[model samples]
Target: MASDMPNWFAILQAQSYSAGGTVPLQCETSATYIAKVIRKVQNQGYAFISPSHEATADFNDVVSRFFDDKVLSESCNSWVKMGPGRSRNLVWWPGTAHRMEISRDPRWEDFVFGRAKETRVNRVAYFGNGWTERERVGGVESITNYLKEAGKGDLATLHEAWNE
Candidate 1:
């Protein structure tokens, strides 16, 4: 006998917003979904543990683009000391809330491409910011709560919320 694996829908719903307008998620691509799922998995204390070169490259490229586009300007000054062989896994530390790392795995490409449809579906399921303020007020509390909950797990949550 084997224990049942967790359902992605259950996991996602558990992390869904408690209070917000009912806006539907809409992911634009499979790659985006894959990234979000990866973030969620990472947030759960599970390493992405990729098994293919292509997956590793995909992860790296997406991460690089995310940091370069969104984080570089505001948080570039902080430096995180790296071990001799840890350069590849290091990125700028954003105070105590955000940390980024990258590692290589030869098997991720296989997993990603092999389950392309699943990836696309997840990407679609986990898209968009589900909340907005009436007068343009930022939902900082909501956002922080979401991040704190998601960050407690793995990178999968981060990826899922990347576009949000």
Candidate 2:
């Protein structure tokens, strides 16, 4: 595991917005932006770790090293609350046509460190005014999949987007 939080975390979070359904075309563009961030991180070698014995241990370790318990509280934010009982969503915005969250019991670790396997994290289409109701974005996999065919120049754009 990484000894410290990656510098990109703040950059991405700064660019992230919590209110969904307000900005024009935010859903798709935000997804693209977040996917670019995820792809950038993956390029650095981290994988998405779903909830499990392994995830628990990893979450504990990451929190111990990175999260400040004093700063985190039971979030009443609808975005934070809209997920599996145990899992937590971090990068999602209404525009991306997807609902992405850590695939485990609610914890803030993945919010900071990301996860273990590329697919270990959960990604699904979201509908309505961002109430966490899931609808399908047919034939689409994760948002990151959108970049699978991206060329070097495309990646360079993403690097610029994330200041990488």
**Candidate number with greatest lDDT:** 2
Question: What digit string (tens of lDDT, one per residue) describes model 1 on residues 1-164?
Answer: 00122212221221121112122321122223445556555433342333345544555565455445443334434333123422322443222222111212212334422223334445443333454442237555544544556437467666645435
lDDT of 2 at 42: 55
Error of 2 at 37 (Å): 2.5
Cα lDDT of model 2 by residue, 49-138, tens digit: 223445546645554443223222234444543344433344433223332332112343434444445434432111224432122452
Relative to the unseen true structure, what is the C-alpha lDDT of residue 67 in candidate 2, on a scale of 0 to 100?
24
TM-score of 1: 0.22
- Displacement of residue 123 (Cα, Å) in model 1 is 31
Off by over 4 Å in 1: 1-50, 73-75, 80-164
The weakest ten consecutive residues by lDDT in model 2 span 96-105
Per-model root-mean-square deviation over C-alphas: 18.3, 16.8
lDDT of 2 at 89: 42
